[model samples]
Target chain A: MVDENVSFEDNLKELEEIVEKLEKGDVPLDNAIEEFKKAMDLVKACDDKLKDAQDTIAKIVNENGEIVDFDVE
Target chain B: MVEDYITVSKVTDYIIELFRSDSNLKHVLIKGELSNVKLYPSGHLYFTLKDEESQIKGVMFGAKYKLKSKPKSGTKVLIKGKIEVYKNYGNYQLYADEILKDGIGDLHRKFEELKEKLNKEGLFEQDHKKKIPKFPKRIGVVTAANGAAIRDIITTIKRRWPLCEVMLFPSLVQGERAGENIVRQIKRSENFNLDTLIVGRGGGSIEDLWAFNEEIVARAIYMCNTPVISAVGHEIDFTIADFVADLRAPTPTAAAELAVPQFKEIRNDVDQFNSRANLAINKTLNENMARLDNIVSKKLFTSPGEIYAPKEMQLDLTVNRLVHSSKSLIMKNQNRLDLAKSSSVFKNPGSIIKAKKENYLLQFSKLELLNPLNTLKRGYTLAKSEGKVISSSKDLKSGDELEVEFNDGNVNTKVI
Candidate 1:
């Protein structure tokens, strides 16, 4: 079974790569169809990931052993 | 023979002449740990050289100091210069002409000083760093024009992406003046519209790569708007410029690879995309055609207009049947009328009237055969007076006349 919890960014990146490849027209017909299917699946996975309520911040302990919220900036 | 009292001017002149003429003190070498190093606004260098016992004041003029590489305080160095006396304050100092680092140098201290200065100025901040292009149109190289680094970069770029244009801004890569020259070329290459900069020479010792480690070069790299990829020295060696650059490559070839994308891979991807799109379009067309065929083969389509046709045919058949039955009914009624018309009383009322007239005549004849009129026709006469016929003469009056009648003629006679 495929992993349902794949990261949104990873799925999006894969989809973009597939789109780029498709636009570039370098793959064989069979491979293109396969990649297109994978791309569609990735698009759906990305949508699923975004559909859930988001967790704003993640906390991790630094080298000093103090927990801190990850600062996006 | 001895002037016990010498003038101040004469004493100063004598000391100056002695320092200038004294060959032994002219090139004497002194080893000491440096301290109190100060660079004046006039570009002159002032410092103190101290050993375990004592310290000596030293001054290196701007011209000589500018030629020497930077040396930090607490660095151990050997100085070669003459000792001279200043008459103004009557102070003795060493006016140094040459200075060289001696023992384990103060590289770490210099590195920390540069790092701190640049960091405070925000050179190492993420905001100041430029992003490397994913696909560079042109790559500008700032290295020795004929060095191995340039060759490596060209070869690597050609191998990865043959379409990218590589332009070179050649500069001195190793020496006292290398730092300034490298910065100059980097600025010059900016006008060339380079997507990224590859600034370095081949692998070398620390001293050889010292130009790249200079604060000026690091600042230059940081100030450049274009993304810089520094590939100085070997993989083990890193410089301050590398830290400040947008990216750090372990070798010159690696930097070239990072500058451009692979053409072959991109082409292959493009082909794949075309194939996929073609397949999808074909599939859609085929599916639509199949649906159309299915609709055409359905029973309703096979016999078109059938729903209205049957009703029309049934109406026509009923109308024909009605017309035939009505016509036959009318003809049968007409025949019945003809038959009634040909019957006796209906055929000729005049003839019936004639027959009735004959019957009446025959009845009248029968009455005549039974009556006296017929006897009269046979010549028998009955005479009557008044309203009654007289059967005997006893009823006759003496003066009365009697009359007799016949069927064709009537006759009257008088009785006496």
Candidate 2:
């Protein structure tokens, strides 16, 4: 699935490989259309990820060695 | 007594002048253990030098004393400087221009020795370094719980790559137990499955940053499965942890920058790939369409009858041959019929029939001449008595019943 669960790196890499294959122009017309659609979807997903990026709340290890939210003023 | 009372500033100035004039005080060297070390924001160092019996205040001006590793508390050092009196405090202190580790057990010497040993042991080999993940989802930082280093790392990572999660494995970054604390945290970080572990602290004096130089801490970083980025002290300071770590960042923020890729660059890559794919697929479609057009424009498709033109000509030739042959055959049969009709028997069939009839009549008359009935018709009678013909009168007995056959009549008579 071309969703948020997939790493941005993996999605980008897959999109790159597909583009390379399509650029070779050896794929059948039907498959070329399919891969082209997938590439577009990946582009949107990556763009969405970038635009929706929010500041991550950092976590800290307390003195007792347990992780908890680290809020900065 | 009132006239002899000199001002406090006046007396302090005189003492400062006396120390300046003394040759011994101008370039004095003192060996002592550093204590109460503090590097102010203005780059000035204020510390106390203490021997077993006594202690003295010392100040190292930042402009003149740029050190690779600043001296921290408990670091034994030999300082070369002239005595100077602070105008504000009016207390005389050592204004050091040069400071060096006194002797054995010096932090710098220990760092060099460990670095060389680790290098010889191949712990610092490039092959041993793991590649920091290009897009790390989880980054673990090992540093003081409340320090600029942690804040810098977390803020940098969050700003540049919010998609990534930052986990802090807070540990003492200095003091006696700092080394063991760092080693323990590094070991604990292994269980978190961190993509990158940034073990660091903000810039500080060499002794404050000494935990990162510990052999145990270096080995922990070297053995860590996660890629470790060592960010200790300042840019000029390189610790043993830096040598053993997978990568070394001049500062903690730099470590976060190295751990994950920026979101904008990744988006651009994906956009480029999309355009390329569209271009390629469109090119493929265009090429196929062009090929189809080339085929559709062909004579075979444009003028479909052209395909069967030769076969049609062949069919025409075969039909012409059949019609011509049949007409010739009909003409031949008609000619035969005409030839037969032109023969004498066909032109004069009645005369032939008459001649055939005359010949038949003649044969009939000849056959009639051999008939005995004809003799009866010529007035000769055939007489028989008891089915026997009478040839002579004596053959006929008187009173014998005889039947005479004439041409058209038969008479039963008795001989008289």
Candidate 3:
């Protein structure tokens, strides 16, 4: 159950592994196609993460609590 | 009225009384670097506090010692106490009650002590340090949100890779309560589900960056489940946080760079993988196709027509031989009939008619000899049962109903 907020490193690593397996060329055609699809998805996920990045400025209000915008500062 | 000159001791006493009477001189906070530091056998400290231009004598009674580290020569310190004039020496000195190692030296001493202790505890061991994520979805920063550190980090991450979200856990970077605040923020960062954490502060004197050097903040960075990148002060300012962190970045911007990758290079890498994938699949398909070609080119498929041609010719040859055998028999019979007609029957027609009549009479007499009436006259009787003549005894069952017909009479009986 991978979520929407997967880290960039994990996604890139999965893409790398898939590409490696694909490059080895030992897998059957069907499996190679599946690996190719997975690689493309990871690349797209990484690209989307970069594209969707937003600027955020926040401050800790409590000892272990939410990050509120430090608008006053 | 000319004022008379006072004695030297009397004048020095007056100056001392004036210094003691002044509140500013009695309770003061002074910042300076120490020089000529000495500890007496009687448990007293003597040092000169000096800045670039001036120097002042300082003294701390042995009873007033509250320092974790003894002050050394050239140590920067902040001294608090009253100014006193030693009448005999005719020199004024700062009688210190509290001596705090100031700026770089004071915080640095504490930083080193904590680093040594934590290192022995294996907190700084390589295996204990988690690898900083190469690609981070969220980065938690424990620093002032409005400061240059946060701004630099944000800008660097955005420029290199924009997909990552930067979460700032604003904390006090300096002052008496700064270490507690930084520790608090680091603890809160655990809830962020971050891939990497950057705990740092901007460049300042050691006093301003002291929070990063504190043991509480260093331990907090060590215990974090998420990988930590410690970036404090300038390139030369090392802190305990840096030593305990998974990675040490010389500056806040460098921390951001360490946590994420540049987008352009990643895209190029993915493009290479795409081409490699195509080549691999095609290579497999081409190899399979060549194998199929090798099989199809073998003699089995190359000359299929010639392989079946001999069998077809053998079937046709058999049919021709069968037709010739029947035709040859009919022709031989025709030749025999022509020879017989010319030599015997056509030339002796009258003799042939007589012989034919005689042969017919002989065949009729022979037929008469095989008649059923002659057998009956020879005392050969015929019997029938159930309109069927039984020729063998084995044909009859032991218990049976039988009807027997003899010559001219019929009888019914149950066989024994």
Candidate 4:
């Protein structure tokens, strides 16, 4: 399982590695199926992480576009 | 003995009065080169006045010493005062009330002497000098708080490095207490952890810069771990502090400039580095992406399995044809073999043998019609003599033995 607590940059790096491996296309059929499943999961994870960051940033900016500090959950 | 038969106190008083009332000795101007001059802690001055002929001891009490500037050994000066007698030591000394420089002043001599001494000690050696900081976060200045020099330093530091913090330690730059004050400020600035120290004041005579020239101030600067920059007086002016400091600037403004680097220039350099790095990374990424695009557009990537498709189809077709033709050829050959087997004449050997036997029997019947034995079966007799059959009368001879054979019996006969 990927650690959600990892920094966004680290997660992005891992995602890039996954994409590169999939692009190489030398995996065995069974391994390829497994990698494909993992890639799908990683894509969703990255998307979720980005969406969470965007929402947090948005919350920081009010309708007037003024920055404000907020507490973490 | 009778002339000296007076009380000791009275005699001493009389002698002191005689010396004090001497007109030539009182308020007289004496010219000589000064030597062994000392300014005592009591604020009194003591020295020996000497000439080519003789020497005389002189004393300037605190009252008069305070009224005039301090002098040192080898100073050529004229003193206006009275010649007085010391009854205890029985010595005559000059009590100077006024002193003036007849040639070079004693202060200058002392300045030169100290300069020479320190120079020989290698305190002014260039190898000991340290480089001033290019950028100082905070500048520690040791000067009179209200002096023009401090104001100038602050203004220059603000104009050059606005972000830098300026701290001041007020000190008396001239006087007997000046050296101690300057040293104290230097130590205090060190405790404050100032990035750089500017210890100096505005232009002045050698007397004014005397504090900086003092050994105490020099030692303080030398011991300070923080970088020290001395800006004393004008460009031509130098002091002991200057030699001991890390750097010497001509003026306070120069010191400020030396201490702080231009922020704009640094910002420009940083921006340039960032832009160059970004361009390099972008170029790298673009090249990598172009290579990836080239690989993706290649035939192998379009359909990775297409390379083997033709061979696989060829194999499939060949196998099908082989199976179909092989089955048909096997059936055709089998049919030909069955037809040849069914029509074969040599299959029944016993029937051929029987047919041949029947043919032989018919031939034998035909042959039997010509047989003489058959005639004998029809009641005709055959005679023979000596195993010979007689067929005609000519064949029979008188002496011949004849035998007659019937179908069922044999008979013997003689013919004559």
Query: In model 2, what lDDT does residue B334 have?
Result: 100
Q: Candidate 4's residue-wise lDDT over B1-416, tens digit each?
A: 78868887677888889887878887778999999998888888899999998999999888333443477688778888889888877788999887776743666777678778878988777787766665555677788766777777766655555656677766888879999988987887776667788888887656678898888888898888888999888777778777778888877777777777655554443344334434444454566678789999998989878988999999999999999999999999999988888763558778888899999999999999999889888889987768877778888877777778999988777777
Rank all candidate structures by their DockQ, best first, as comma-separated numbers. 2, 3, 1, 4
lDDT of 2 by residue, B1-416 (tens): 89999999999999889888888898989999999988888988889999999999998889224765566689888899988788788998999888877763576788888889989999999999999889887899999888888888888887778888889888999899999999999999898888889999988667778888888998999889999999887788788898889999999888878887777777667677877887898899999999999999999999999899999999999999999999999999999999998998978889999899999999999999999988887888998888888888888767899988888988899877
Off by over 4 Å in 2: A1-6, A63-65, B1-24, B33-77, B84-93, B99-105, B315-416
> What fraction of the correct interface contacts does each predicted structure contain?
0.02, 0.85, 0.46, 0.00
* Residues B1-416 of candidate 1: C-alpha lDDT, one tens digit per residue: 47698888898888878777878766778989889998877878889999989999998898333443456789788888878777786667888887777742676678778888888988888877788876665687788866888878877776676655677777899889999999988887777677788899887656678888898899889888789999886788778888898999888988887886665665444445446545654564566678789999986789877767999999999999999999999999999999888898876799999999999999988887798777887877778776578799988867777766667665666777
> Of the candidates shown, which would achieve the greatest lDDT relative to the real structure?
2
lDDT by residue (tens digit), candidate 3, B256-326:
88988887888777677667766776787787789889999987799998888999999899999999999
Which one is best on TM-score? 2
Cα error, candidate 4, residue B329 (Å): 26
Docking class of 3: acceptable
- Ranked by lDDT from best down, the candidates are 2, 3, 1, 4
The estimated TM-scores of all candidates read 0.44, 0.69, 0.55, 0.42
Model 4: number of backbone collisions: 3
Q: Tens digits of per-residue lDDT for model 3 on A1-73?
A: 2346766667777777877787777887778777777776776776666566565443444445655654422
True contacts kept of 3: 0.46
